[model samples]
Target chain A: MTSEQDPRPRAVIVACTDGPLLVRGEIDLISASGEAIPRTRKTVALCRCGVSTIKPFCDGSHKLVGFRTDPVPPADRKRDEGIVTGEEAPPDAERSGA
Target chain B: MVVCAGSQGVDDAPVRAHCVGMNAFDWARRSGGPPEILFDARGPLSAHLLDVLQRPVPESGEMLAALLPATEIALSQSVDVLRDDDIQLALFILYGLHYGQVLPADEDWEWNPSLITARLALEREFEKRLRSCVPMPALPEVDSDAVAGALFDLTAPDPGPSLSRYAAKRATPGQLLEFLVQRSIYTLKEADPHSWAIPRLTGRAKAAMVEIQADEYGGGLPERMHSTIFAGTMRHVGLDDRYGAYVDNVPALTLTSLNMMTMFGLNRRLRGAVAGHLAAFEMTSSIPNRLYGNGFRRLGYDTNVTWYFDEHVEADAVHEQIAGRDLAGSLAEDEPQLLSDIMFGASACLTIDGWVADDMLDAWSKGLSSLRVPLAVQSFATA
Candidate 1:
């Protein structure tokens, strides 16, 4: 895993169960108008609930609105099996494959 | 300035004399060296502790011996230790020793066995009171997803008396300044208390804490650190931005909020409590921050004055997600035994903070000052 030539993706995003999409690593966040959203922190949580006053970046409105994500299907859960279930997996393991 | 007097050197005369005409708030502003003792003794325990702290360590033995009795007296007389000005202030000073620079004392006193004994004495009661008083939510399964969902539900917005709503819609300019003063007790040293658990935590929880803290510390830019940003807001509004500058102004309950966090963060046994505390803290921050910013803006303050609140609206939004899931949730999953404490911590945050808010709104509703001492500086009149 420490090898310089490792094939794992550097930028990963975790679809936090029933919460925001937690994005870690270097990735440009752009708006639909193609304007670059100014990223200030190293990691950012993008709003998934669609009601966040601060678009792109979450403002914790998900909780207020009772936002819910559909349960992960067993078939899809299989593909991300070890990454999600492994105790030693990195915090951003959900999308490490991409 | 009065000189240290007496052979035994246990006398508080010099400190008291020095504070004669001037209050602690003024004395703190005048003294230039390491954060001068910014508050006065609320009762015998704090009086003795402050007196001992000012004198040299070698001469502290006699004064130190008086501490336990004084603490006992203060604790016994007080109906509620949490709201006891004397006990809370003494604990704040004791904890201040660990944080450094806040208490005026010998560096050697940080590890003083006597002080630690007194601190533990106070902490045992404080924690017990907290555990008894703070309504604990029902525990969720020992899984991250369940834990996060439960936390979210636990912190869901309530239709109740809210300090943020009052600030947004109806706070007078003076009330806003009072709000800032009440918050300064903790906001000036924001995140330092929680950072204590960095070493105590491991793996996913640790990673989540660092990630959240990095942003709080301004993501490598000292100018942007949340505390510094808050200080700027204080300065922008005509208040002193120095840490502890307003300690004397706030009531005991304000100090209790920060003291509770320090208690949780500093004790490894309470690591789960600290994590839950942070989750509850961040969870409740964002929306209220938006309201807080609106409050400032409503009062004709510019972006510079409101930036601190605005920053929280975005920053805490991200932090709450990470804190609830990756930090608090993960900790509960890994250490199933801590699940109860985790819920307890979250509940404690809401209950205690709710009390603080209620106190403020109560005062405002009565057209009174929330601060124990009203701010001397007038609010910057907006055009």
Candidate 2:
């Protein structure tokens, strides 16, 4: 498909063993202040903790602060189902068909 | 006006009110709240707002005028009131009435024809002024998918001192908390504003918005909800997290950012703008949030203080795609007419938000407070 016709969204989520999560390309980043970061050159990192030498991007701040993203237990984990089930009920009957 | 109408907190009310303007009964939310008399025509704006809202139907034009002085003023000025503190604050409050943030207005006014007329009239002027003042980015096509690309392009910030970069590197704890206070105006409301488009869209676009909003609402867990998470972050930093608690402390620029979103999301005609706005927003979020979290960490704050930013790092990475493709792209495919609007919305978000960020960073760089009233000026004893 041409770029315009492509419906599959693309993104890069890089997991760092001893540092911050490195992300690249089209992503939305709203700060705690509700401001959007204007587009940048397709690469960024997120600090897992408040402490990052890199400020906004993670420069291994989590390791210093001991941040952890423990994986959810098998049964409890929602398995990235691509959509949340039962969580979002439609508004009503009349507000259908857009 | 459907199942979701009742399933709301104060934040989501704007989404419900977006398609419709405030009616007489809806105006009651203004009474005895927030220092300023928000609506001021018949009684004080607040009192008249409540009086009209408690009624079952539309009030007279004079009554409507009392509750919507900002609207009247906006049309006459022809200047963008979206950033005017008085006008934006009042408009935000007016929209809040329809969202059912507090008690429901009188039942009869929910669909009052005359009240709707007044809202439409006000909105027309508000939008007209914005179009003239809010510079839009040059776009290639008016199609939905192309609109997404244009929006992405529009979100790019011009070179300078971005607040996130500064916060990460240099902000003091007190300064950081103050910044968070300005953000609380919208972050506390989180995804409710954008959710308004869910009912106004269909197919890919509708699904896309729901996909992103579901995460924003924190799936099923109330504590994990973005708004709830933000409140936790606020409490971590010793700021008040209750809704509208710090409304007075913020300046017009802060209020305008949200007013723009509400204005974009509430108007169905601007659905593409909402989508593009969201896309541009998400596309730019992940990195700065990381910096924000780190900035707090650098100040010796713990994970609790940074969870909001951390959460965005993960959530928005996923949301960016959902927003860009499913929401914006899908919308363009469904309604080709909105392509230019979508582009316009995204660019508007970037330009307006850039202006505010620059304002905050510039103030900090100059060693001045960014809030409307500086922190030192407010006496704790009286407050």
Candidate 3:
């Protein structure tokens, strides 16, 4: 069967805000040296914070260190900085380069 | 309502005796031993309930009429229902019928309407007391991320007296055994109470719950099941691995901890609370489990004994994330009305569990046994 026609659901990785990235479905977890990381659970949480006692997987140390993440979407963040909307750009006459 | 032929225990003795006589005959024909009494009844309510459950249900009038009044008297007499031995044990027995094998009685008694009525009466009061005493946190906006954030904040590590810390640093070997016995009330059954919410949920929330529960059930490997792993830990530590083996020894608050979860899970309206409870439960687990394992290791116990705690350290880390965001957060987003209940459930879990911990720490601090009846004297030989 074609990839699209495959009956099984594809893997999903969710970036949980202020928390680890939750991975679901069947996916190979590999190390920097290209060796497989032994994952025991079907769904696993990969550490987003660098301080986890168990690296590559969260041991919930994020809360202890007060980790955080920007909740805004990247595109929206850029827009907010006036990259797209130009809401805070210099006055029209001052836009000499344009 | 399957009514007994008589209203009073004294009046019903002859009929009960006849029923017990027949049951004994059938039991003897089928087995080498008499039916095992599962637990010691704490008071008249539990005592009477246990007596009636052992025999066949009568074909006639009100057998459990005494249960309602007994429950009423117990509730009225007890100052705090949560800590009251009789009320908690009676509640535990009634809830046990649903869990199965908890009471060695006629299976038909599981659905006997009178028992159900008495259980409902006790549950009504139990829930009322929990609500009255267990402080609820402020509700977050009806959004998944917001809900998750609120729960994480609520369960954030606090500087209170921690039982796990005591287990790590100061608990005696005997105290360690008490710890295992007290926890065995729920940990041996593990993820079962929360699984009741599976059919009650939908979409993202349902899938999230199943994912966590699947892991809790040991990902289809029986030996790896959390409960099985817990049992192995119990056995390695020289305690009986059978469920309810230590029921008679634990205080009411220990039973109350499990009873709270079952109550929330079994009631459809409290599905949100169960989800939130699971989230908070997972959130608080990873760190303490690490400490618990350390305590056991400090006492020279090996991987076989520490494996349960070590396993939870990783599993609950994964589970807390899923429980917080995918399960509780998504549920709040989907069904906004349950948001408060979800918060209530999470807060209640922390409150009751904290009390249980305090109970143990209080006893241990005083150089006393945490259990209602201390375990029989035995050597805890470290490997």
Candidate 4:
């Protein structure tokens, strides 16, 4: 067991069911143009919903926008308040290979 | 000088000056451990607790036995339990028995039936007040995603006149120190209050809590521990960084805030409330912490003084996700019966914290010091 060569610390990002892509492990986060983004903590929540005031970071805006990946009961989703239209944004920005 | 309701402040100055002799701060400085609390007993319950703390164990235990009934009576008659200085201080002191360095008493007092009697009496009233006043939001479905969604919506940062916003733009150096003093009551202890819930939690919820706690404890480096980092900021700004250094200065509501967390965390049954409290706490932390950091920078304090706030801005963003989806949400999914308490806990956090902020802002707006005893230090290293 000691002799086995360990692979690289693969950064695993969990696509949270209705929220951000929770990223952890050894990961290099860069901008679209390949600029290094400074990270303060080991784990981070990258905004899946585009509505976050803090871009590239989930300021927990998915909840504000009612961003859902799985089909919730329509009645629950249609409850009277705080759900912005999810259609104009990317279907799933993290999954869209950005 | 503290001018409470525009009272004559000079008479109390000498009394406050006397408060420094062998108090919590001096003990903290010497031992780097939870200091024996030396604040004046505000009323009978606290007086009994403090006196018992000074006696040897058997004697203290006997004293407590004699006093528990009186303490229970005092708690029962309290009209405003939340603001009653005596009950609040007594509760803070009892909770202190669990978290060392706050009390220099024997460890055996931690589970003494007599002490527990007083703590329970106070907690019953305190919890009743919280549940009565802090209206719980409608419960979300008992699923990870739904519970997380509910918590997030509940704790969404308010866009109104707030303490962070006020401090960011206009607070004087003295005001900033008052702000730090108010926060020091909890920040010095930092994540320990919620840590009680760790053993009570299971499965994904437990794993998630441990992960977040790992960061809170500074990812294996003691120097980077959030509590240690906060102490560094306090020292940078020329304030005492000792735990409970400013406890005597803080108001009843301030103690109530930490006591609430301790209550939720300590009780095994309130695991759901503790999780929800942590979730709401993290969800509401980042942005205001950014504003708080900005306020320090604006006042010419450098990163040394701002690191605590700056660290929270990003750290909590990460913690919010883990706390919401993984910890609190997973807990609800696993134990659906706790779903309502989860929502109630989140709402209580927001409600109590809102009161704390309101107390500070109102005091600041009125040109009054928010502290019970205004901090004596007035000068700061300026821009």
Candidate 5:
């Protein structure tokens, strides 16, 4: 969490369509109860499709579960840096921060 | 020792003398190593290729002369080229030349025109057969998300009599060893076939591939490399961990699985297919790996034996995303024309590997060994 003054390190989480949410950058993944998630790899796919046997981290269970987002095609998804995402984009000034 | 061992193709003495320059008999005696020669000739092409690798390649002119007849004979005789053990083995050996330690041939032989000619002759037939066999999937719009979505769908887990499920519940210890033996052909050389595509790609796609491969390669820890981890699992299961140790045991279909990747990877024209192949491969890996690990655990094996599969459970979770979106998907975004080939590559992987799995499961269900050679002895089993 960022202080009132200092900004949080911008972590981009892309909610991949019919798939897990891919979180990039240095992230301190944790549970709702504040338990820290152990991560070995830098970028992680968090289980948005709750059926993943491995909780928190995805093991690609979404396809079997038929996870879907909006019916809108990917062309409408906002582009951040180079990655096109299903989520809304940051403000133009914030996009320029990188 | 396994490096020098090509299983059965060429004569141990001459090939070793030619390649390693050791007194083959003495080295054999002192080391008590695995059989370190080219394979026993399975078919005409393989017989001819083994013969070529045995001889020094300055004799390529003569090698070429002898090879053409065999290549021509094999090509002419083949109907279902995919299952032709002779041609597949020949291709496997040819590609093995690029990955050192599998074939005991001199370095000069890799680029020898005659060998390339033979490999290409076989590959053209093999590629033709593959293209005919697996019709390409419908092309998605050339955007990263669209392409990635298509790849994800193509690779989604099947709801059927699956090999992983069979392994998890039914396979015996002997069957487990056979599983390792069948898998040894590819798992030992993990990430290598696809790594060939790294230099072929550029920008986000290339970077994405590099990212996934870096993890596959153990992130600078050589011992932790997926291939090394696989080798460790082999050692745990009391199987030979050395590369090509089990090449003799696997059937043509198993070789075809790897050979397909090599064909895709080695040819720049099929670069998109290779990317898609890796995506489908990674996409399909994690969940099955979980079941595969459970299969070994059901047999009462410890973590040492299952770590390779366990590692894949997490590693490929991350990899599938990169491979689906950043690699294959991004590659499609860059080269719109390659989108179709990319889908073909993914389908071909599922089709070929699906067949391989069915072969194993059917063999197991029949109470038989899946490997070409029934594991006659468990070397690590204390009698």
Candidate 6:
């Protein structure tokens, strides 16, 4: 287990079904061209390739380029939205007049 | 909650069974989910900020101790302060502390006087520079009714590429990604910047802001939360979705967009700007979102990929009216003195966003990458 005080920053990449990678944790995140940035935060997003107007973050650029290594159904995507909304609902059982 | 406006289902249900509400505009599809930080030795500026925030009276302390050098430089030059990427980045971090997106300097630092003094010092200049360029509308006699009208007048976007229109037609895959990256500064946190104004509002104005915000917040759904949906979009596209993940790539102008909103929302004196910003934001959202959806679909994306834009097409149609008339209008009616600031704030959103859009299109048009530097690929690369 790494302690939060560990001076060394290890970046983790979590994969989702739709767009860019979500990045968290301590990282220098220099550009591939090598510009040392001035920010020191616990989390930051970096662009996967040379795109992203928002730069270091993913803005669903893969879709624009047809970058498809992971192909998931649009249904799964809908369910994901449901999960996000459903969490706020007390319970599914409560919604229907059982 | 689900007012069926689009169509009815088999049981004569609303055709759009999907809530597909305002929360959709908040989502940005990224690729890699997000990373976790193991540990770190704090930077001097971030560390000092933490110390001050933890203090008993952060509202009156040395929040800018580590940043004095940069501050000195900002105080020295005119062209540098607004254009200097470093100064703007630093200022962005300092403000980020208060917004709760970045880690706190010290809990007490949230309101520390000296730290605020430092922030105020930077903001005084920042605001002056912003005001010089912001194009404030002429104020009518201060009254709630007059103020609202001014806000509506300001939100009418002047002719430009209509980035959304451009996105619908011309955006390449790379350009779309770049667009998302630029949007991350605000979308990752979604409605929070404007929520800062919630406490400052009263009666009808407060109610309107809350009504609009509630939809922005997915009406309490976590999955539906715009930020989370944006995170999903990030994962879909193979980018990082974590909050504050892309601070490095944003240029000063990009940071200024978010900073402007925070500046308006955070200050009680600028409540009108906050109202005006929201009004303008709502007014401008709809058609462009449709164009964005078309752009994604043109590239062969399924509804999942384009749903966020699709949702905005419907939601912001309703939101803009509420924001323009009820929120901004009512606030102006309640407090006419804020009219000019309200109009200025709306125009600021349009103006700053125009700069960001123009910068992106300019890069793409020139066959160039819009990011500060190209992302590294260990094996293969494109751009």
Best by lDDT: 1
Instruction: Using DockQ as the measure, name the better of candidate 2 and candidate 6.
Output: 2
- A1-98 in candidate 2: lDDT tens per residue? 78679876577675543235656557788778989865332345676656654456553224223343665466534433332222121111100001
**Which runs in model 5 stand beyond 4 Å of their true positions?**
A1-11, A30-36, A71-98, B1-35, B378-383
C-alpha DockQ of every model? 0.15, 0.03, 0.12, 0.14, 0.14, 0.01
Candidate 1 deviant stretches above 4 angstroms: A1-4, A71-98, B1-36, B381-383
TM-score for candidate 3, please give it.
0.86
Superposed Cα deviation of residue B224, candidate 5 (Å): 1.7
How well is each residue in B148-193 modelled by candidate 2, as lDDT tens digits?
4555445432334567767777887667867887887788778877
- What candidate 6 gets wrong by more than 4 Å, as runs, is A1-98, B1-66, B78-80, B103-108, B140-150, B377-383
Question: Global lDDT for candidate 5?
Answer: 0.75
Show pairs that collide, candidate 4.
B34-B101, B35-B101
Each candidate's clash count: 0, 29, 6, 2, 7, 93
Q: Which stretches of candidate 2 lie over 4 Å from their true place?
A: A1-98, B1-70, B77-79, B102-115, B141-147, B376-383
lDDT of candidate 3 vs native?
Answer: 0.77
Which lDDT values do the candidates have, in the order given? Answer: 0.78, 0.60, 0.77, 0.75, 0.75, 0.58
lDDT of 6 by residue, B232-252 (tens): 555455455445555665666
Once superposed on the true structure, which residue ranges of model 3 sit more than 4 Å away at CA?
A: A6-9, A71-98, B1-31, B59-62
lDDT of candidate 4 over B53-155, digit per residue (tens): 7776786656768677878778777888888888898899899888876756767888888778778878888999998999879989888888987887777
TM-score of chain A of each: 0.63, 0.46, 0.65, 0.67, 0.58, 0.42
Better of 2 and 4 by DockQ: 4
What RMSD does model 6 have? 21.2
Q: How many angstroms is residue B226 displaced in model 4 relative to the true structure, after the best TM-score fit?
A: 0.9
Give the worst 10-residue stretch by lDDT in candidate 4 chain B: B1-10
In CAPRI terms, where does candidate 2 land?
Answer: incorrect
- Give the alpha carbon lDDT tens digit for every residue of B1-383 in model 5: 33443222233433333323232333444567633563466876787788778776766567568887789888899878888888888899899889876767777888877778888888899999999999688889889988888887676654467767666767777877777788778878888999988898899989999999998888888877888787767655555555565677789988998899999999999998999888888887876777778878887788888888888877888888888888988899888889989999999988888788778878888877788887656433321
Recovery fraction of native interface contacts for candidate 6: 0.00
For residue B254, give model 5's deviation from the true position in Å: 0.7
